[model samples]
Target: MTLAEDEALAAAPDTPDDALIRLLSHRSWQVRWNAAQNRGASDAVRLAALATGDKDLAAAVGQLGDALSSTVLEAVFEHPKRDGREQLGCIAHDRTTQERLASDPDLKVRASLAGNNEDVPEDLVRKLAADRRAEVRACVACRHALPEDLVITLASDRSALVRWWLIFTRNTREVAELLRDDPDEVVRDQARGVLGEPPD
Candidate 1:
């Protein structure tokens, strides 16, 4: 395979899974690395990454994030390759998986759990809402269909960024009213923008 073709294979976001599987074993590490990073990479790719023992490639499996099934994620957490833990939190549906990741030291991991999964349990959502980090709380704010009490609570969040995301959820009338006079100008402006829009 030519370097140019390898580079093209590496860079193309839409590279098919079969091609990616082939590239995972290709002679060129660069092509392999790109295949690992592609969004289309699948559980098979992750399994291959695990087998290859290339830490960076294994870590790139994080890009698959919410796309991964619990079975594969179990493999990821079991593996020592630690870099991708951040994105793996997205698909953590199992209570044990959520519990393991919920208290992880890394905020990116917690934030991914907070924002990425539609099926994330309400209890976990509550825990993430109260996270000390604004980044994690902001991710919670971006979630749709939060419990009503949470809408009110996040509307008054100490972090302006959290409140800003709350405004964008467009979940309740109270959100606009609570933030219309917010101390943060950007939040106030966003609140104004959504004032007349119907709540979702």
Candidate 2:
């Protein structure tokens, strides 16, 4: 942070205006950050810096006016970096992006999309309810607006945990009686609690 270091950052690099872009590949995050903040930086410069997995520079890129558009979000989901792909399902407002991420091949990312209720597509959620992965089905059980039929489907999910997650949902009354005989003792116990006391 000394004047000498500031001057070093300001000095022209051999690569024309590409100095800021090239600095994004530097070994030190400090150098990459200083370049990200350079007044003359371009979107190309910022995006290159963002793709580096530097949290601060990524935050800076996210603050840009056009950040998080569907295409950019898609690229983030497609990127080789884990941090970028992990951010895919967290985007709430863009239905196009949400739909794209919902079909992602990665099970973890699909589970994240399964749980998002805001502006999320119902068809996509329903499709996710049938995902081969029990973890994704468990997340579908956690969604607030699920259809009653889907709730029943989850009630019988092969994974005990997936079936157990359905206990927190309220509209499973039609299936609650069947769950009384569930092979899993904990699921049977949860079904009793969800159904309350039987007629005396």
Q: Please report the candidate that would top lDDT against the real structure.
A: 1
Screening candidate 1 with a backbone cut-off below 3 angstroms (N, C-alpha, C), the clashing residue pairs are none
CA lDDT scores, all candidates in order? 0.77, 0.66
Please estimate how well model 1 matches the true structure, expressed as its whole-model Cα lDDT.
Answer: 0.77
Among these predicted structures, which one has the highest TM-score? 1
RMSD of each: 6.4, 6.5
lDDT string, candidate 1, 1-200, tens digits: 78779868866867777788778877777878788776666677668776677766766676565566777777777766555676567654567777777787878778888888767789888999999999999999998659989988998899998998888777356688888888998888778766863322
Report lDDT (Cα) of residue 120, candidate 2: 68
Give lDDT for model 2.
0.66
Where does candidate 1 stray beyond 4 Å?
1-56, 59-75, 78-83, 196-200
lDDT score at residue 142, model 2, on the 0-100 scale: 84
Query: Residue-wise lDDT of candidate 2 within 99-173, one digit each (tens)?
Result: 766777888778877875445678888888888899888988888887778877887889988877777565256
